[model samples]
Target: MTSLSTSKLLALLALFVWQAHASLANSPRSLPARDEFVCPAEDIANTGCLGPKDCLYANPNNCNTFIRCIANADGTGTPVVLPCLLELEWNDNKKECDFPENSTCPPK
Candidate 1:
């Protein structure tokens, strides 16, 4: 390839790398073993899920205060390290996890 073309390609590659790094840094922090789960510190009281199987009581202490625990294979509870269960987002006003689509979060 021509020297100019090579240089342009390299520059583009560098820009892509930089943008990827920035995006990752700005993204929400995921759990250690489960990356699909992201728990923001502001909305979490602890790093665990709550459910029937995981917890002796369903929705212990009104887990609604934080994220809802993940469900077991049979639909029980499994305490996870993530603040909220997968897909459930934190609702600041409601002070709990809720459906993202139903949430009143400002549009991106």
Candidate 2:
């Protein structure tokens, strides 16, 4: 009975820790607004894309963030920084967020 009670206590502790970590990660104070994130100058200068479709690029500096270039009628684009869901990374080949193991992210 004592062992069972101890196990339950440990489980509750783990649950509390996980909840706290998740809440911190999702807190507005921890992340910037989508519009507020500024793309690095290198990313802006390197985009060769032009036209109707938005372009997606992996963020070289941050595995959790990606860049999206919104196409304009004038053949220019505005770069926006975006974050992947927790524990995921940008997958350049598949053009979406994916698990880090399956992504093309360079080794840190």
Candidate 3:
């Protein structure tokens, strides 16, 4: 009698553990983010304002330029804005984003 009761108790405990683990594994935080901010030419949709995840992205072909999605203040999204971060500038020859300290851009 005791053996059967103990076995049933263990089964119930195992079931409870399995349920807890399953819920956590399927939680919302485990899901992937749908919005991604692409730099320069990679604007998903020009919204003018950058989302929380928006930031400078590396471009191997343009060291001085990055693919950034800048938000427009007028509430109309139609342009692709390419602004270099801090000290970095777009380099046409390197095909990658580069810092200005180590390189100089010709006066425009």
Candidate 4:
């Protein structure tokens, strides 16, 4: 092949490799799961603000734990509300809802 044609081919091949790598890297590792928790209506309304597909839950520990639903950003499928645990002051130590054992919060 001519030198010009060879260069074009190489460029196209490089572009393909880069695109493939990016796609693989950006692919979701796994489907996001949902967690269940209970908070007062006022707390829920104030704490975790609802987003397009996810809900923000207040993290008791960091003040950033927001429970969100797992779904594509495009908003498809049944939205599942995920439970997030926050750290609250317990005596002198920070306390959070334990997993499996204390997965769901008690009724308010």
Question: Candidate 4: which stretches are off by over 4 Å?
Answer: 31-108
Best by TM-score: 2
lDDT of 1 by residue, 1-108 (tens): 999999999999999977864564344432334444333332233423332222212222233223234444443343343244445554555554577775444444
Candidate 2: misplaced stretches above 4 Å? 1-54
- TM-score (all chains, Cα) for each model: 0.29, 0.50, 0.27, 0.28
Instruction: Quote the lDDT for 89 in model 4.
Output: 17
Candidate RMSDs in order: 13.3, 9.5, 17.3, 14.5
Scored by Cα lDDT, where does model 3 land? 0.46
lDDT by residue (tens digit), candidate 2, 6-85: 99999999999778755643443222344554444443355544422236767666788777765455555555666776
lDDT of 1: 0.44
Higher-ranked by TM-score: 1 or 4: 1
Please give the distance, in angstroms, between residue 65's alpha carbon in candidate 3 and its true position after superposition.
36
Model 4 is weakest, by summed lDDT over 10 consecutive residues, at 88-97
Candidate 4 residue lDDT tens string, 1-108? 999999999999999977864564344232243223433344334434344322333333322233332333333322222223233211112232244333343323
Q: Rank by TM-score, descending? A: 2, 1, 4, 3
Error of 3 at 21 (Å): 0.4
lDDT of 3 at 12: 100
lDDT of 2: 0.65
Better of 2 and 3 by lDDT: 2
